[model samples]
Target: MPDLSTTYMGLRLKNPLIAGSSGLTGTRAGLLELQEGGVAAVVLKSIFEEEIAAEYDDALSEAARKGMSLESYDYYDYELRGAHVSQYVDFIREAKTAVSIPVIASVNCTYSHEWASFAKDIEAAGADGLELNMFFLPSDITRSSDEREKVYLQIVDRVLKQVRIPVALKISSSFSTLAQMIDRLSKTGIAALVLFNRFYSIDFDIEKMTVTGAGSLSSPAELAGPLRWVALMSRRVGCDLAASTGVHDGAGLIKMLLAGAKAVQASSAFYRNGAGSAGVMLKELSAWMDRHGFKAIADFRGNLSQAESVDPGVYERVQYMKHYAG
Candidate 1:
């Protein structure tokens, strides 16, 4: 059998398949299922910064309705942050105890604030690593691109300062200069970078005349974007690259590795096929590796990336050719 083990974000994975954060990985039972199904690591479902703030605001409104004093708002805010952090800390501790595979705590934060310090609590709770799901929609026309990019950098810097464990960033590809942004972020001392987060899109409900969700889950075709960027940036960036979004099967997993992703994170596949999807993908990868006469992941990984490919321009090509379009 080919050795599938690889290192991601400075942590050794039994294999390169990671169960990405989702409802499937939010609970102790879910973590065990992923481990039993053969995932090398698990990124716990992210604790959202907005969710905490929303909860705090709701609680304050309730307190006000009950005639709470004005001075109590500060206490309420502090306790609210603590309440969510305490629960997440316990979740991390329990997950660490239940499973031996690396438990990577995830935080979905829009800005670098008091919540960045919460990473320290997660680390102290025995999380092996942290993955920051950092992104903000660049819809504000008044904000310059540079100003928006600084938010991501500041959050990363603050979080890294608070935790000793490896930190990886899961980011969106929505940037004016994505390559430059990736280069700058990679130099900020992160252990790994997950290319492209799949965000919830808005869809119009024609019949109801209201907005609804648009394609909540990713299709295999979605892999092309990240695959291209990973192949282009894997060698150029200062940190390891992990591919996220649009990976649904073993072939997709293998392609990500070939494109130079040190690891591949799968969420929708697990949701569609259950935890066994990880095992299925690994089996397929191993069989492919054996057929190719490769003994380990590193032996063939990045073999097709832009840096190593003979036809490197294929990755750089953007415009659809008339010959192909026709």
Candidate 2:
């Protein structure tokens, strides 16, 4: 058998398949399942910053309505936030005890604030790594790209100052200067970068005349965008790159490694195919490696990246000129 072991974000993975954060990874049972199914690591379901803030606001309003004193209000506020943080910290501790694989705690945030301080609690709870699932929609037309990009840097700086474990930033490919933004972020003392987060999209309910969320699961067809970017940026960036958002099977996993991803993260695959999907994907990866006479992941990883490819322009080509002409 070909050696499937690889290192990602400075941690050794038995294989390159990671169980991405989702409902499936939010519980101790789910973490155990993924480990049994053969994933190398697991990114715990993200604790949302908005959810914590909203709960705090609601609690304070109820306290005020009850005529709580000002000092009591302050105490209530601290306790409310701590309650939320403590649950997540406790989850991390439980996951560490439940699984032998690396447990990566995820936090979804849009700004540099008190929530960033939760990184300290997470690190203290025995999380092996932290993934900041950071993004804010660029809907505000008045905000300059620089101004918007500054928030990402601020959040990263704040979180990095609070933790000793490796930090990974999972961001959407929404920046105006996408490559430049990625390059800048890769140098920010992060251990890895997960390319292209899949955000919830709005869909119109034609008959109801209301908005609803589109399907959250990613199709295999969704793999191209991140594959292109990983191939293009893998060699250029200072930190390791992990591919996410569209990897559903072994072929997709292989493409990412060939494009230089340190590892690949998948959530939809497990949701659609059960925890065994990770094992199947790894089986395919090992078989492919054996067929190619490769003994380890590094032997051919990045063999097809833009920096190494003979037809590098294929990645940069935005139009199907030849096909259309034919």
- In model 2, the clashing pairs are none
Candidate 2 stretches with Cα past 4 Å from truth are: 67-73, 322-325
Compute each candidate's TM-score over C-alphas.
Answer: 0.97, 0.97
| Total residue pair clashes for candidate 2 | 0
lDDT of 1: 0.93
Deviation in Å, model 1, residue 245 alpha carbon? 0.9
Cα error, candidate 2, residue 200 (Å): 0.9
After best superposition, candidate 2 residue 267: deviation in angstroms? 0.4
- The TM-score, computed over Cα atoms with residue i paired to residue i, of candidate 1 is 0.97
* Candidate 1 lDDT, 132-200, residue by residue in tens: 998899999999999999999999999888989999999999999999999999999999999988999
